[model samples]
Target: MVDELEKAKPIIIKRVKRKGHDFHGGSWKVAFADFATAMMAFFLLLWLMGNTSEDEKQAISGYFHDPSGFQEKAGSSPAVIGEGGANVAVIEIETIQPETDDIESEISKNEASNKPLSEEELAKLAEQKEIEKLKQLKKELEFLVENSIDFSQFREQVMIDITPSGLRIQIVDKDKRPMFDSGSAEPKYYSKTILRGLANVLKQVPNKLSVTGHTDATPYVERENYGNWELSADRANAARRELLFGGIKEKKIARVEGFSSSILFDQQNPHNPVNRRIAIIVLKRSVAENIEKQVLGVE
Candidate 1:
């Protein structure tokens, strides 16, 4: 009777069925892939922001804000969403115009200068700018002399130095190679080339030029009437002609003078080859003005 009761009461079996994520069928995998992609994009955004310049960031922001307002030259840098490795500087981005009239006064207030410059202030500023310009020109000339293949053979003969007047470029005669034929105004081929090259460079600047020709103490015996003075003047004119041929304008030439053994480069040895030189002076505006005034007997 006891066995019969136990069998009737507890004859049930407990069977558990196992389940798998296969029921979802790659849904979780899709979510995981999306998460990874988003992480990668976030890292990339951080990298781009770090590499971009402040101006570029503003430009990009401006673009996103108002693409219609964007203005830039064609064929500009497009590879990196910024400047590519081009010879030109990165294009300056123009900001979008203000939409609201309320900000107009504020903009004007910001744009308005505190005070206009006085004449004296203007002159001082101009003088400062001229000094900077001369310094930069000196640097460029020095760089050309040091690294240019065109001036390789004539490096020793080309001397550049800043003077109280302005920047002075002297092309002196070497022991073996003189700029001109013996006691002649005609320039050597290489000398002409040097002057032409210099003219090409100098034409870029707006400064007036002064060219002077010099000769050694040795007197010219080529002609009875013509001496070193006339020879020197002829040489100076010849140099001026070459400069003009090389694209320098006629108006840019301020003075063309000749000092025959008067302003010796080698004062101790006036007869030295170094004393014979052609000097190109980019005169300071003040000095040039003073010279003009003195010549004209103005002040």
Candidate 2:
């Protein structure tokens, strides 16, 4: 019985088996996925191109060709050959070319003919017009002041002139009637009446205003920290407030400055009472813009 059991067990045999694709593995699957993704992207591009307008297509092409907008225009940025044949950057300023016969050139020509003036040209023209306007305003102001019953007494004290800055209206201190109390910022009754009349006329125009206060060469005793600077500044601020009360918009007052006996109206006599005055200036737009730029810390 043992021999029969051994012979039956010994009859069993072991064999090795192998699959066909063991070496290739999953590499082909990755390659097929990459191919499918590329085909999808290509089809999307085709679809977009088919739907896009000519201008849009041109714009897209331009973006791809020159991604930077500062592309080299003719005579704008010329290249210079260096000693070692290396390229160096050089700028060349040239006048804009004249009209041409191409359709685009014709359109550009028409645009150039009908186009608005350049910034510089427009500024010059505007300045000229502003000068004329200020001249007219000066005439009107003179007429108004001359005819007004309230300003009859103060006629000689009012001085209006056209300056490079704009119209300057100076109210001087008179021997009989002072604009302010001695060594004070408070305006007298007559001063208020004059300021109010000027404000009424000034409010009619869109120009900005600059109010400046001047003091005579008379010395002030330093009581605490108060001196000429304080007095002058306070007087300027006081004038600004009065102008606001006289219907001039607060925003219209661009500057309030104090020049304490520095810029004298009567240079020959620094101590002249006329040096103690208030100057109201209507600033030109360009000058005002420059002042604003300076205030904003721009170059």
Q: Identify the leading candidate in terms of TM-score.
A: 2
Q: In model 1, which range of ten residues has the least summed lDDT? A: 80-89
lDDT of 1 by residue, 109-164 (tens): 54586555566755665666667668777866775565444577998999998887
Q: Show the colliding residue pairs in model 1.
A: none
Looking at model 2, the pairs that clash are: none
Candidate 2 on 1-299: residue-level lDDT in tens? 99888888856577878677854789888888999999999999999999974434544554455544434322243222222212121212121111123334544665789975566754565566667777777876786566455577899999999998888999999886889988789999889988977886687677789999999888767577777777888888888888888789998888999889889888999888898899999888777777789899987
Stretches of candidate 1 above 4 Å error? 1-121
What's the true lDDT of residue 269 in model 1? 89
Error of 1 at 75 (Å): 23
